[model samples]
Target: MGKSPSVGVLHEDDCDEVKFFEKPRKNLQSDDENVDGRPGWLPDGWIMEVYCDDDGTIYRYYICPLSGTTFTTKSEVLDYLFSEMDQCFLESKNHAVGSNLTRTHEWLPKGWLVEIRAGGDNMDKMYKFYVYPPNRVRLFSKDDVLIYIKEMKISGFDTDGQCNTNTQENILAILEFNPEGLPQGWVKEVVFRKTNTGKIRRDRHYTDPIKNYVFHTKRSAALYVETGKVTIRAFVQKTSVHEMYSFEKFTHLHESLWKRLELGGTNQLRTRLSKLRKLSLKEEILSDEQGSTSAEDCNSDNSDTAHGAGQNKVSHLASTTVKRPRGRPPKQGNARK
Candidate 1:
């Protein structure tokens, strides 16, 4: 008979160290008992075979039942199992979506589930929404949900074809930040602006009371408060005098204020404004210097005028007292006659 290939024996080059062992027996019992009569945490049908070297060093190899693949560590087996579970979950979600079995949210694509659960502790009667995507990953916030949806679209996983404009609007409506939930002294502001394409885009801003900075998103506000650094896009605007009024009045502030509220909420506006102030200061200084120079010239002119007047008076006295020749002396011939 031809020689049969041995199983569960890894090549020496495959691992850092080489180990030799006796052929493992077939039909092993439970995973725990199969591991040299020791308790193991491996799932059913997984085999943990022990090996030894001449130096009395021990090595363990794990075998996957379904694929007959060999692994050197328990973590590898667990990772394989998790990957298998994810595949299975994905298939199930696809099936559910095709059959219209899963509950759908107006905002989310079909096959995605949204669960509303009553909040615990201080939340009391409040309810929180938890989203479950087709991948079975639980999402807790609107930002996370949006990110997941974006990734799905990028990966071509939009099975229901419901990730349309209306669905997006519904999602935004549901996930919109509630101004009433803001902390004391913190405000939420929304500014509607037209893009270069003339599409109306709504920008949401959150104020951090502790840092006194305005962030474009709540996550950014929290991050700034935690790190003491503005890690995201932020804007600086003059505190409005109309802040005490109602929201409508605040929104209706001067048109110039709206212009200041545009995007690029980083140091761009700040640096630009600073440069303007510096230019204005320079102009003012130059004007002051010019004024001082003109004043000095005027004073010198007045001094010169006074001095000339005194000289004129002296000259007038000389002209009246000393009868000096008013005209050139008579010609020499005329004098002789």
Candidate 2:
């Protein structure tokens, strides 16, 4: 029997390697002879090259004329063809009207419908793509289509609100539990905010039920839960009579909680009061240190002034007093005689 054709022996070659073989200039037209040595199956504009190595093993490679790229297997060629078809479909949809615009192609499966629609105002134009399955259910976006297909595969039923299997998992059930080995009563909450530009932003908050504390980020919450200490950084704005200064201040977690607690949460009234008391104690300690420094400076200045005043008094007395002569005796009666 003849040796079976080796499917795995085909490999793509570089431009330098293609220079070694003399390529056919004329295109093959008849179905009797085709590229890859397979009659009546090869695509147009694609040429095949066959070669033998020193070990006598045969290799076949397919080259694309449009892209000048090489493919080693039939699957690669099929993938390129389908991708080109999709590109053409998208180009056609771009010029289509804003109505239903449903289309079906020979390449698509039976009863599958694709639709493209242009929406939004003139200032903000957007295109929305949708797909309808054989069951006539509409799926929006590629992700929705993928999810629908996945559900069909897993449950083997049309997902028209009749599938008994629980396909959609609860995200909070996965996130609320402590995944990062956080403390036992801590729960995670996700907050989504939309900006003025219609963009969505997600923020994570971890809540500690035991201490009634809510941390904005995971790292900070983890640090406090594990170590009982955290550093909070905030931008402080100080306004004076003539100018305003903005500076960043880093304080201990407990001290900053007072300001944050004031923003909301009437249920945390006791917690806020306790945090305020702790904050006041810290401020008192800082004020005491500043007072002691100023007192020491004042004492030093007072002592220097007192010493200079004493020296001036001595100099003034010396200048005003009369100086005694070298002979020592100076009485009133001796002077008269």
Candidate 3:
């Protein structure tokens, strides 16, 4: 059997060095937090803290902008990150691929952050980052845009209707930043305008002094800002023609319109309206064709009489009439006698 190798003896200084190398630096105050040695920077509206456990698990806790608090393990954070920074990295892998694209919004677990260049001549004045899903950051003017650069899912824009909880998590984020942040208006007017649009009815009779309209309907309806006033048009059609008022002219046709609007007017109510208008135009065309056809038939009959067929029929009718008028006079004379 081979003899075991002799173990080397270590000095006190060597022992100290071995112990120091084995011991991790307890950075209670330093920026480096995790295994990746990434420095942590917490944004103004967020709260970041570490959770450590004996089983070698470390969790990063985030206060969600909406619900107030959120937490994920370090492994989970790594899973969600898109990029690796000096001290921190993105949770998703595809984040770096879309760094050059604009209007590309990133989806975080709790909310989303979209980087936007403010509109017009002053391009560099400031780039705006709008956060959503839970929109925790209430940004002041002077903050660095990169402070909130966390991992986000780079998905499409939010073109759907106004979001409630039912909307997709990422979609809600983009919708929150539409028009590069909500337009400057009262919340009421903005919502009202959004909900109304093509759903509102237009008054065809009056071209001048256009009137404003306000309206609503069951389940699905539209309201609009028109003629400096709000107009609403609702309709649902299945069988018998029925229409309802923009404000009060409720009827069969209106119900049909509303129903059609609800089922089909997801993002393009105008397209739906265009289809309906086309149908109306088609009906008008059919009516005009029938009228013209009838007029042409009548004219043809009249002209035929002037030529031969009508005259021949008239002659035959006269021959069959014989002396009916004279026979009536003779019969009356016989009765008198």
Q: Rank the candidates by TM-score, best first.
A: 1, 3, 2
RMSD of each: 18.7, 24.5, 23.1
Please report the TM-score between candidate 3 and the true structure. Answer: 0.22
Top candidate when judged by TM-score against the true structure: 1
Q: In candidate 3, which residue ranges exceed 4 Å CA deviation?
A: 1-112, 115-128, 132-135, 138-279, 282-290, 293-300, 303-337
Better of 1 and 2 by lDDT: 1
Residue pairs that clash (backbone atoms under 3 angstroms), model 1: none
Give each model's whole-structure lDDT.
0.49, 0.45, 0.34
Query: Could you tell me every candidate's TM-score relative to the true structure?
Result: 0.23, 0.20, 0.22
Worst 10 residues of 2 by lDDT: 241-250
Error of 1 at 335 (Å): 67
How far residue 259's Cα lies from its native spot in candidate 1, in Å, is 3.6
Model number with the top lDDT: 1
Which regions in candidate 2 have their CA more than 4 angstroms from the true location?
A: 1-175, 230-337
By lDDT rank, best first, the candidates go 1, 2, 3
lDDT of 2 by residue, 1-337 (tens): 9999877533465655565453342122222343336533448767888775796455667886533557777787777676673343233234222111111121223334333221222212212223353565544344565666667522122323321123211111112323244533344545334334434445565654333356777787666643455447311223210111011111122222233223323346557888999999999999999999999999999989998998999999999999877886789898999
